[model samples]
Structure formats: C-alpha cells, structure tokens
Target chain A: MKISEKLARETLLEMQRRMLRIRLFDERASKMVKRGYIPGTVHTSIGQEAQVVGACMALKSGDHMTGNHRSHGHPIGMGSPLGPLMAELVGKATGVCKGKGGSLHLADYAVGSLGESGITGSSIPIAVGAGLSAQVLGEDRVALTFFGDGTANQGVLYESMNLASAYKLPVIFLCENNFYALSTPSHTVTGGRIVDRAAGFGMPGVRVDDGQDVMAVYDAVAEAVDRARRGEGPSLVEVMTYRFREHSEGLRINVDYRNSEEKQFWTARDPIVLFREALIAAGIATAAEMDAIEAEIAQEVEDCASFALESPDPEPSVAFEHLFTDAYDLEDVL
Target chain B: MSVMTYIGAIGAAQQEAMSADPRVIIIGEDVEANVYGTTGGGKQRAEQGDFVQQFGKNRIRNTPISEEAIVGTAIGAAMTGLRPIVDLSYSSFLYMAMDQFVNQAAKNRYMFGGQSSIPVVFRSAMFYGLNTGAHHSDRPYPMFMNVPGLKIMAPASAYDAKGLLRSAIDSDDPVLTFEAVPLWGAKEEVPDEEYRIPFGVARTRREGCDVTVVGVSGSLPLALQAAEDMAARGVSCEVIDPRTLVPLDTGTIVRSVLKTGRLVIAEPAHRTCGAAAEIAAVVADKAQHALVAPIKRVCALNMQVPFSPALEAQIYPTRERIVAAIEAVCADQLNAENRRVG
Candidate 1:
C-alpha cells in the first residue's frame, strides 16, 4: 500500500522532520565526539535515519520499542525530548536515565522506548516480553525491536521468534541489514536469508529494498504493526540500509573492510536527500518548505546540544543510589 | 501449621503468588507437562494441578528447550510489568543463559539509572546427589553471587523454601532461587498462613559456644547433623544458615565467630571462590582478632561433579567432613591456648 493513500501531507512532512532531526543530531553528536565534548564514543545512525524514523512513525505513542547500541536515532524518532536525550549522551544529571545510562543505554519509558541494550540480539526477547505484557494485559499496543545484520546469527533471536510465534505476540522484529556486523560482511557470516528464517518460524518476512525511502519503510513496518496489533502474531521486516561513518567513533579511519565503490553507492542514496526529492516531486511540499524544515531542525539540534552542555553533572555521592529499589530496605534486613 | 515437602512448598508458592498477583506468570521448558517435575514430583504436582486448565496457556506457558530465550523472555517480561517465574530445569543449564541472567537481568536496573526493574525469578534445581553426571549436577550459586543487582536465595528447608520464594516474588529486583534437588522430597512443618523470609537474614539453627558452623543450601542439613553429632561428643557447635548470599548477613556471622572464637564453612560448590570463600573472607576481615584458630572450609574439591555415586559422595561436603572440620578447629584452639601458656 502507498503511504500517500493513508497519511496526510502534514504527516509526510513530519516524517521528513524526524529524519532530518536524526541526521543533524547525529552529525552534531559526531562532531562533539571528535572535539571531546562527549566523554564516550557515540554510534551515530547518520545513513540509517530513514529506517528508524519510518518504523517509529507507523506506531502509536503507547507502542513499545527496544534498540541496540547504535540507536540514538530510535528514541529521538519515537518522540523523546531532545534535551534529556542529549543530556544523557553528555552524562548530565537531567538526562533520561539521570546520566547513568549514557549513549548505548539511553531509555525514555514515558515515550515507550523501553530501553536500548548493549548486547546484540539481547533486546529481541525484551521486545517479545513487552508484546507479551500487552497481550496479557489485554492492550492493543504492539512492541517493536531494532537489531542489526550482525545480530541475525544470534541464537537468542531465533528463540525469541519461536516464542513470539508460539504465543502469537504483537511484536515487530525489524532487522536493519547494513551489510556488516561491525567489520564482518553479513553475507560471509550469515548462512541464509534472514527473511526466510522468519518463515521457518511461521511469520511473514518482507525485505524493503528502499531503505533510503521513508515511505517504503513506513508502509512495510505499518503493515507488520497492524498485523501484530490485530493479534495476527509477529512479523520480520528487513530494511537494507548502510552506515556512512566508521563502525563507531575513534575507529581506524583507513580500514579497507568496505570498498570505496560500495560506500559511494550507498552515499548516493542518502535517505534525507532522496526523501526530500520524493516530497517535492510528489508536489506534497515546496523547495522553500524543505529549506525551512532543515533550518528548524538545525536550530533544534543546536538547542539540544546547548541544553546538554548546561546540564549539571550527577552528584558523586549518588553513584551508589538506584542499585536497587528503595523498598528493598537493606538497612532493616541487616 | 501445615506439613509440606520442599517441592510442595515451591508449588504452593507458585500457586499463591499467581493467585494473589495476576501479573505473576510461569514460563519454561515442559512447564505444561511437568516433565522435569520441578514444580513438584508425582500425580498432584503444581504444574499437574489445574494451573494450565485455570490460568490458561498464556499464563502457565511452555516454551522450546531454549534457555537463553526462556530467561531473556522472563527478563523482558519482568521489565515491562509482569513478574515472570522462569525455570531452567537444572542449575547446569543456567550456563546457556548466563548473558541474559548476568549481563541483562542483573545490570539492566543499574545501567538504566534505576528506570527499569527486572522483577523476574529464575528458579533452578541445584546439587549433585542424584548421580545425574557433571552436566546435570551443579551448584553454581557462587557464580551468580559475584553479579551485582541480583539477589540469590538458596532455601534449605521446606518452610524456608515457601517463605523465601514468596519473598522473591514480591521483590522488585531480579532474584535467582536455587532449590536443592536432594531436598525436594524432604518434608517439614510449613505454616498455611502466608509468610516471607527477608533476604540477608541469617537463621540460627542451633546455638553453642565452642565453634561456629555455617552451611549454605543443601549443605545446611549436613551441618545440622554434624552439629548434633558434635554436641553428643561435647563439642557444642553453633550452626548458622545465611539464606541469601548477596546481601549476606555478615554481622550475624561475625558475631557468631566472636562468641565461638572458631569458624567452619560448609558448602556444596567448588572450594575456590565459592560461597564458603566469601564468607571466610568476611569473617577473617571483620572478626580476625576474636578468632583463636584458623578458619576452616568444608566444600567440594575444585573439580567437576562425577557421575559415580561414590565419587560424588566423596567430593561433596558430608556430615563427617563437617564434624572433622569442627573437631580440627576446636583442637587448634586448644593447641594455640596451650602454646601461649607454655
């Protein structure tokens, strides 16, 4: 189904807004890491913004999501506030996890971005659990989890799929096949097609070739989300995308794992530029409106960085706090 | 008070918890059929008794033989809202889901700045008395004790089993309860009324002054027997059981050591870096001045649990080993006093 048939012009523009926001936010985050403004390395989703934005756009506010290490774009796309998210990246007290969970562990439960996992294929079962929670509680909220091509080989992912299928859970397993699991080419490592593996587990698996097109990702994920919400069980949507930057910040720049030709091909299909052109070509938005959106997003990203910088560092004494719930009553037990 | 076996207490705990809180659910391999009989062994076991018929398959769910997925699902479900009580048939299979139990379930709360709580119970039957070979016979609670943000409970008696399981279900953090396979059929007087044994509280099974004996999990019964035998021989051994290992009752143990002036730790796990080692370190670090003799640890040898019943019996801590350790500690104290007087 075409996205234009279901969504209005404003919704299409908003999708572009989220994509641009992720792009600019990632760019600034990369610069901050380079300048030593951010303490730890940040995994920027620069080239893969459309997949995150598109998938998040298809879900309701109460729908749950779990992300991986390279997932700053996910919570941002799920409508998390820029200030706290940025604050968390900079280890500020005002951050979403109070600065305890920096870049890799960012979580905003209010927006149903359950949390991001540092372990590959770890969040898949977590997403299944969220789906189970919705099912057991008699809610229509579906759960979505984003993993990488590298995580396809993880045994736990298969186990999660089997459980989700057996229980008919409302979950969307979105695999972002960026051709590499870190430096290892996915083809050399992964045995069979990931989509086919989903079919083995009794779920529909679809491959979306246009990772650069936001509407394509939105439509594919929207279908999966609808099936899950309808209690039709889980579906796997593989969005083929690429990472323009190194695997992470501070990696060897001259690595030859990915050839120049491959890099150039994906670079030419930058999701933001492609989606912007699609919007203009479809006569849904003017060039001036596109320019205005970019300017607003740039300002929004700048404000996020400023707020993150101005936020206070967590108190040194509070480091031991939150290890367990206050109701634990360790003192009384002793 | 109602009489219940160790396994019966476990089933009662599951039934009461699920009845009291609808959010509590069970997921594991063979939970529907009770193949391993972990819920209870026999015709009227908990899994056999109308749980699937009443709670439906959604709540009392069964899964494929995937340890990682079972634990991962429980962790995820716990984080969202449900209190999942997942079983991993035997303690040896826990190695398959170490990443989920250690890295994910244990560290999620601390890593996420306490924004999420993994209120999941990973229940496993532990020990080596069944001659199930090395793979099936394991008491690996010490490995979990090293992980922060995880509460480890090893209940020895039927009464403590029910009470502690209930407490674990009510706890907001992730808890791993290791039930001794040998103690499953051991019966005791458990009250019908609801009760919960708080974590980190050491229970004094017997009081004495000559030597302090501390046992963990299945080793507690051996220590109690040794204490009785030593009492008949006029040794006056004091027995203490530190129910939960993470928030260990160091104060209670240290006080016991100060009063007795000697300590002996009995455990079923490997001697090196086992629960006994941790308890020994705590007593040595805190109550060293009060100790008149060197601390003794009666634990299994640092090797795999053998399949042969004789070999397994030789390896694990026994009542004779506990008695010998107590006698040696008492003898050393006397020698030290005599040497100082001379």
Candidate 2:
C-alpha cells in the first residue's frame, strides 16, 4: 500500500529527521577530515539520503541490512546513534566498534545493521548468508543490502543473488546506482541497467525514481520487504540516486569521474529539500520547525564530534589483544 | 575391541561429538548423503544422518560452493554464539577462504579487542599421497600454524588424531584440525570412550640415543621406519612427534636433543618455510646449547610431485632420506666432538 494515512505523518517525520542526520553527519565528517580531526577519509553518503532512510524505514525488527563504503548515510538511516558513528570515525574508544572498525565497518546487529565492509560487494554474500540464517532460524527476517551500481557488475554479487534466489532466501538486493563506480560511469562500466542484470538472475526487479521523492523509494522497498517476509525469495531494487559529494574526504576533487554540471544538476534536487517540502505541503511541519529540527540535529552531531575528540585512545596493548583466547607469541611468529 | 582406521576414528569422533552436544554441528560439501559423505558406506555403519536431520539443518547449515562465503558465514555465526564445525573437504580449497580464516576469524577477536570469541573448528584432510595431484594435495600445517589467532593441530597417529580432534572442538578459540589422508587408511585400536589431548604437548613414540628425529603429519611413519632400519644399522634414533605444531611440545624434543646432542627433522612436504623449517628453527633457538651439531632437515624436494610411481617415490620424503639425514647429523656431531677432544 502507498503511504497509509496513519504512516504518512510518521513517515514524513522520519524522513525529515533521517535526511537531516545523514546530510549533517556527512558534511561534518567531510569538514572533520579536512580539518585533520578525523585521521582517515570517508566515502560520505551525502546526497543519497533517501536510499538509507527509505529502505531502513521499510524494515521490521527482525529485518537486517549490510552497507558499503559510502555508509555514513546507511548507519544514520538505520537509527545508529550519531555519537558512536562520529566516535568511530575519530578513532576513539567510544566508537560503535570500539574504534577497531573505522567508517567502513560500523555495525550494530541489534538495530538490524549488520556491517559495512571495506571490500566492495563483499557484504552481498554476507547478507545472503545472514538471510539464509534468518530463514533457517525461522525468523522470517529479510536482509536488505546496498551495494553501488558498479557492485552489480561484480561476479560475487551475481553469485550471491543466485544463491539467495536458489535458497529462496529472504534478502533484498538494494542497488544504489549513483551513476558512477568510482571514476567510471554506469554507461561505460556496467553492461546494462542493474534491473536487467537482476532479471537475468530470475528475481523480481524494480527501478525506483530515487530523485523525485523519498516515498517512492520507500514504497518500492515496502513491497520487496513484504515479499521477502512471505518467503518469495529476493528482489533487486535499483534506486536511481546521485552521489552529491566526492568519493572520500582525502580525495581533493574527482578528476574525471563526473562533469561539474552533472554534479551541480543533481545537487539541486537534494532529498533533504524534497523531504522538507513534502512535510511542509502536508502541513506536518513548517519552514521554521524544519530549521529548528536541523539545528537540533546539528547540535547533536556537534556534541558527538566533541565526545569523539574528548575520548581517550585505546591502550597500545589493546591493538595486539584479542588475537586468541590464549595469548599468542606474536614476536615469535614474526 | 574393534580395529578402526584413522577415517573411522574421525567418523566415530564426529558421531560422538554430535551425540554428546547438540551445539556440535557439522557443515561441508557432500556432508549429507553426497558422494564423499557416509552414504556409500557399510550396512553395519547405520546410514549417516544428514546435518539437517542430526543437527536440525538450522545448525548444520549448507551453502553454495563458495569457500569464502562458507567460511565467512561460519566465522560470523561463531562470533554470534554458535559452535560450528566447518569442513573444507579438501585442504587446498582453503586458499579460496583464506580471508575469512586468516583475516576475519584469526583477527576478529583481536580486532574487536577481545570483545568476542570464535569457538569454531575447521576440519580438512591433507596428504600428498592418493594421486590427488598437487591441486588436491597439500600439507598446510606450516602455513596455518604460523597464524597467531588460530590453533593448528595435525596428528600423525590414530590416537593423537582422535584426541587432538576432540580438544580442538572444545577450544574457545578457532582451531584447525588437518587429517592426513595417508594415515586415514592406517588402522589402530582407540579407546572406546571420550578423551582429549591438549595442544603443545609432544608425544615420543620411540626412544634412542644417537639422534633426535622430529616429524609431523604423514612423515611420522617414515621416521619410525627409518628408526627401525637405522636401529639395525647401529644408528639408534629417537622419534619425537610434536602432535600439535603451533603449541609445540619443545620440552620433550629439547630434552631428547640434550641427551642425543644431534637432531634431524623429517617431513613429507617441501623443506623451505615448511613445518620442518619451523621445528629446526625452534630447536636451534631454544635447544642451542643441547645440540652437538647444527640441526639437519630431511623433507620433500622443492619440486612438483608427479603421478608416475617412480617419480612420486623420488619426489616425496622417504625413510631413506630420514636415515641419511640422521646419519649425517650424527657424523657431524662425532667430528665436532673429536675436534674438541684433539
């Protein structure tokens, strides 16, 4: 069903908060990296706010999802506490993964957020396996996974999809096709539309209008999530979004990735603006109220950064610890 | 009462483990009535229970032929509180899942800074014999033993195999148990009960005076054979089988080397960076003063193992090489002692 009247207000409220959190976190992380506060760079999920919020909103308690490098938006969308996400980026003990897993590996399975892997398309197989586990455990949980448009071309993705479909696993393959895979565009790199590729795997496929509104993305995911819980196997959903920011903070500027005009063109139709307008049109929120929400989230993220900065670094031995239940002679092995 | 082969001991141990603990689940290719599974076996053996029926399939999960995915999921499950016995039917297939093994399971506990434990056990068979060729045959104990987070156990005899396999299963950390194929057909009487041999302890199968011989995997038998022929030749050698390589029971080996003053390491695999090198290095490092002469290693030539019987015989380490290597070490010891006396 399209956004039910009851869910419309709640969905709009969720849309505004999540979009703001993701965009704010990404912008702050970008600035932190630039200011040398966060050591490593991040593949900020800046402009692609709807994919994370929409897909996660569609999931239930048992449903889980895995993310990719551009995962800041992903965890934010999964209701991850912004404090831990910021702490992890800043390499503090207070981080979600205790600072071990930087931006790429943030995970809290409790929130149905499994993890985001460093290797592209690696999480697809894990999602498949976790979906398989959910099926075996009789949890009726769907594992929703997001890989870039380029990841659709990887052999492992195809393999994972085939295996999931073969087992009729409760998995949702969410292809966030932001046009380019690093420097390569969808036209040059991918063979065809990711939907067609999903068709080849014998799974129901959809190409959602990622840019027009968040509800469209949410509706497509709701259908897929429903089908997954009913044990109808997996579905491939290619959300046509755009990457608003550069790949990572360390990247000075994308040299040949996309034209400046194209980047400018997509930034105008930002999901945050569309979501705010939707809320305003529905009389659920005012422009002033939206600004206050933005301010509130901004303050929360700012405190998260300060908390990350104030936290102590893990002891040196902490680095070498956990290799084994029993202590290992690392010096001996070396 | 019944004589059992190494393979039988393993099967019995699995049946016993599954029967004893509901948590003990098995996952692998062909584990459920497949070609290599228990489907083709004897009538008296009672048809093997598929993982689905035995462990409820929920625990005894199967997956596609992706070793990476198999191992990755197993590691994930183990971390999330499940004791999984993942089977990499062939030891060589381990190459495909090395990241999950070496990187994830091996490093997860440490990466999370000891926040979690992976109580998963990986079982695979290794041996150069059986004409499986190079691809199917490899003794990866040396490669895995060096991994810090993992406990690598490769048993040479039937008793050690059963006991060590049991212990590896119970370990809180991830453990690797490599069953030697050549020893699979070798039969012996194992106690019809439960037992476990702790890792790092060495078992001395034989005792002598002139030289100390350390062997692992299928090479132990060849060492015992050489000891017999050498005993007749007046070169009495002590054979020490360090049952578990990583947690090496160097105490027994060092004590033997202290008495004999000469040492020789024999293995059925390549010499460079093999288990042989690790043992020799350990001896030279810890038992330096005890060694009368530099340690000598007798191992497979650094070359491809061929299918032809003659070439295969020449390619792998044999009793002749062990005997020769022991003799050379003894001769060198005698020469050094003589020089000192003079």
Candidate 3:
C-alpha cells in the first residue's frame, strides 16, 4: 500500500520536510565538522534520508527508537528539534544530554529516542527492551532500532532477534544497509542477505530494494510497525540504501574504497530530491510550496548552527555530575 | 530471626521484591528452572515451586543463552520502566555481555546526563572455589568495581544477602550483585522483618586495636578466621567488609586504620588492581599519617586460575597467609620503634 493513499497530504509533505531536515541539517553539520565547529567526528545521514525518515515516520510519537554512530537523523526523523541536537554536537550546556553525550551519543528522551551508541550492534537489543517494557506494562507502544549492514553480522543481532521473537515483543529490527561499514564493503564481510536471517527466527523479513523511494520504505516499515503494535511479533526490515558522503566528516581514511561511478549513481538518487519531485508530480505540493519547505529548513539549519556555536560550554563540574543518581563526590567515592 | 543459607536469602529477597513491586521481573538463562541454584533451590522456592508458576510466564521470562541481549534488554527496560533482575549465572560469563554491561547499563544514566536511571540488577555468582575450572572460576567483582556508573555489592552472610539484595532492587542506579559460590550453602541468622542495607557503609565484623584488615567478597571468611587466629597469637585485629565496592566506605576504613595504625586488605580476585589494592590505596590516601606500618595486601596471584584444585588453592589467599601478613605488619611497627630507639 502506498503511504500517499492513507496518509494526509500535510503528513506526506511533512515526510519530505523531515527528509529535507535530515539532508540540510546533516549537510550543514558536515560543513561545520570540517570547519572545527563539531568536536571529534559527525556521521551524517546525507544520502540515506528517505530510509531514516520513512521508518521513523511510520511509528507514533510515543513509539521508541535507538540509533547507531550515524546518530542525529533518527531523532530528527522522530521530530526532535534541530537546535538541541546541533547544540549537543557542539558540546554546549543547553544541548540535549547537557553536552555529556556529544556527537557519537545523542539521546532526546522528550521525543522517545532512548539514545544512540558509538558501538555498532550495541543498541539493537536496547530497542527490544523497550518493546519488552511495553508488553509487560500492557502499553501499545512499539520500539524500532536502526543499525548498519556492518553491524548485521554481529552475533548480538541474532541473539536479540531470537529473544524478541520468543517473547513476541513489539519491536522492529530496521537494518539500514547503506552498503558499507566505514571503508569495508558489507558484501565482502556479510555472507547472506540480511533480511533472509529474519526467516530463521520465524519472523517475516521484508527488503525495500528501492529504499531511495520514501513511500516504499514507509509502506514496509508501517506494516511492520502495525504488526508489532498488534502484538504479533518483531519484524526485520532491511532498507537497501547508500551513504553519499564519506563514512564520517573529517575522517581521513586514505583508502579509495568507493569508486566515482558508484558514488555518482547514488548521488543522482538523493532521497530528499526524489521525495520532493514525487510530491510535486503527485500535485500534493506545488513547486513554490516545496521551495518554501526547503527555504524554511535551510533557515532552521542556520539557526541551529548559530545556536550551537553561540551556546556556552558546559560547566567543568558537570564532568562529575550525573555519574549516579545521588550526587556523591567522585573523590569521596573513589 | 530465622536460619537461612546465603543463596536462600537471595531467593527470599527476589520473591519479596517481586511481591512488593509488579514492575520487578526476572530474565536470564535457566532462571525459571533455577539451574544455578539461585532462583529455586531454597526454602522459599520449595514453598513457591517454579517462579514461572508463581509470577506467571510474563513476569518470570527465560531467554536463550544470549548474555548480550539479556543485559542490553534489561538496560532498555530499566530506562523506560520495569526493574529487571537479570541472572547471568556465572560471573565469568559476564565477558560475553561486557559491551552491554559496561557500555550501556553502567554508562546510560551519566552518558544521557541524568535523563534516565537504569534500575537493573545483574546477578552473577562467583564460582572460583567450586573447581569450575579456569574458564568458569573467577571472582570478577574487582573488575566491575573499577567501572564508575555501576554499584557493586558483595554479601558475605545470609542477613546481608537479603538486606543488600533488597537495597540493590530498590536502587535507581544499575547494580551488580556478586554472590560467592562457597558461601551459598553456609547458613546464618536472617531477621524475619524486612530491612535494606544502604550502599557505601562498611560493616565491622570484629573490633581490635592493633591492625585493620579489609576482606572483599568471598575472602571475608579468610580475614575473619585470620583475625581470630591473630587474637589467639596476642594480636588485636579489626576486620572490615566494604559491602558495596563502587560507593566504597573509605570513611569507615580510614577511621579503622587511624585507630589501629596498620591495614591489611584481602581479596579472592587477582593481586594486581584487585579490591585489596583499591582498599589499600584508599586507606593510604586518607590515613597515611596515622599509619604506623606499611599496608599489606593478600590476594590471588596474577595468573589464569588453574584447573587443578591444588594449584588454584595455592594461588588464592588463605587464613594462614592473612595471619602472616597481620603478624608482619604488627612486627614491622616494633622494628621501627627499635630502630628509632637505637
């Protein structure tokens, strides 16, 4: 089923809006990281916008999600404001997590994002846990976790799938197979199709071959999310997508891993541009309205960057804070 | 008061906590079957039968031998709601889930800037003296003590087992309870009324004037026996057990050392950077001027725990070694006094 048939025109436009938010925000973040605004490195969801926004938009606001190192997009897709996320990337006091998590770890509990992890395949089971909580508490909320194809081969994924299926948990194991894990091509390391592994665990596995199509990715994830909310079980949705930029901004991996032709092919199918054109072609939005959305997001991205840069650094005392619920001095405890 | 084994007290605590809060649930390998003798093999389980039958399948959930998922799921659940008691069975197998345990459970609250508290309990038994072999036999509490966000509990008696377990369940932060395998069968008097032992409080087992000896986890018995032996040998030795390692009661140990003027730390874990080392360091830092003699430590040798019982026994600290260390520390003060007189 097409999302356009069921979803409101505004919601469809919002999907494009969020996708654009991810694109422009990440694009701005990329430039900022290179310019020494963001500390460490930032993994931007530049090319894989549709896969991120589509899966995230499928769930209700109360539904939970966990992400990997490519962190900022999941929360943005879940409708988190751009300011705190950008502020967090800059290590500011007003940042989400109060600058403790930084860029690699971003958690906005206000929007039900449990948190993202730097370690691949680590946060996968955490989403399963959110599903477990919902079931035990008799809540209708479902949980979805995002991981890369590189993390697909991790044993924890199989362990998590087996547990979720055994308990009939309300969870969606969304594999963002962006074709590579850093410089290593996933095909070189991954033996079988990632979606096929779901069959072994007695769950339906759906692969969205055209992950660049936001609606296609949405239809698959929305169905999975529906099944999860109805208490059927967990489902594995592998979205075949690509990363337009390098693995991480400011990372100098000298290896010429991705060829120019392959890069151009993915660059042409940019999820944001594709969704914008689709919206205009369907008469859901006029070119001027689409232009206004892009302009609005561009302004939002600028405001976020300015807010992050102008924000104050966290107090030095915050380093010892939040270590435990009780504010015992670290010196005394040690 | 009633007589109960250490492991039995743990079971009582679990049943009590579950009864008190519906949010409390159990998840791990063989928790329903009570294979490791943690959940069932006691007076409580004998009366209640299978936990699955008592709490139903939803509350008493079992999982495949997936330690990583088991730990990670508990962290996620804890963050949202529901206090999970994850039975990892053996402390040695904790390595399989270290990423979730150390990276997620321990750091989640702090990493997220106090946005959420991970109120999960990871229960694992130390199997060092059970001849479980090198792979299984390990007192890994010292390693977890080094981690910041985690609260570590080592209950030496049936009373403490019940009380501390209750505290761990009630705590908002993530706590790891390391149950000593050797102490599981040992019986002690536990109060009939419910009680909770606060973390960072050191329990003074015996009072003395000559030296302060700190015993960690399973090694508490050795220190107590050594203290008794020292009493017979005309040496007064005070023994302290820091129940929770992370929120260590440095105040108690420092005060004890100030009164005694000497300190000796004993632990079942390896000698280097073991619990003993941390306790000794705390005493040295806090009460260095009061110390009349150097602090000595009695710990297992830094090596892979051998499969042979005899070889393993040789590596771990013994009552005799504890006594010897006390004697040497006491005599060292005398030598210092004699040298000053000359």
lDDT of 2 at A272: 82
DockQ (CA atoms), all models: 0.77, 0.37, 0.84
Q: List the residue pairs that clash in candidate 1.
A: none
Q: CA lDDT of A324 in candidate 2? A: 66
Native contacts retained, all candidates in order: 0.73, 0.27, 0.80
When 1 and 3 are scored with DockQ, the better candidate is 3
- Tens-place lDDT per residue, model 2, A1-334, is 1333546566678777988898888888889998988887888888888877888888877677778888777878888789888888888888877788888877765576767777787667667756766765566678888998888777768767877787788889998988888777777976667788777778899999654367888888889988988989999998998987677777765366688798788898888888787677767778998889899999988888888899988666556656668756665545
Candidate 2 matches the true fold with a TM-score of: 0.90
* Candidate with the greatest lDDT versus the true structure: 3
Q: What is the lDDT for A246 in model 1?
A: 90
Of candidate 3 chain B, the 10-residue stretch with the lowest lDDT total is: B37-46
Off by over 4 Å in 2: A1-12, A326-334, B21-24, B37-44, B47-63, B114-116, B146-148, B208-210, B234-236, B246-259, B332-342
Candidate 2 clashing pairs? A322-B110, B200-B247
TM-score of each: 0.96, 0.90, 0.97
Query: Cα deviation in Å at residue A44, candidate 1?
Result: 1.0
Please give the ranking of all candidate structures by lDDT, highest first, separated by commas.
3, 1, 2
User: Candidate 1: RMSD over Cα atoms?
Assistant: 2.8
How does the DockQ of candidate 1 come out?
Answer: 0.77
The TM-scores, chain A only, for the candidates as listed are 0.96, 0.94, 0.98
State the displacement of the C-alpha of residue A65, model 2, in Å, after optimal TM-score superposition.
3.1
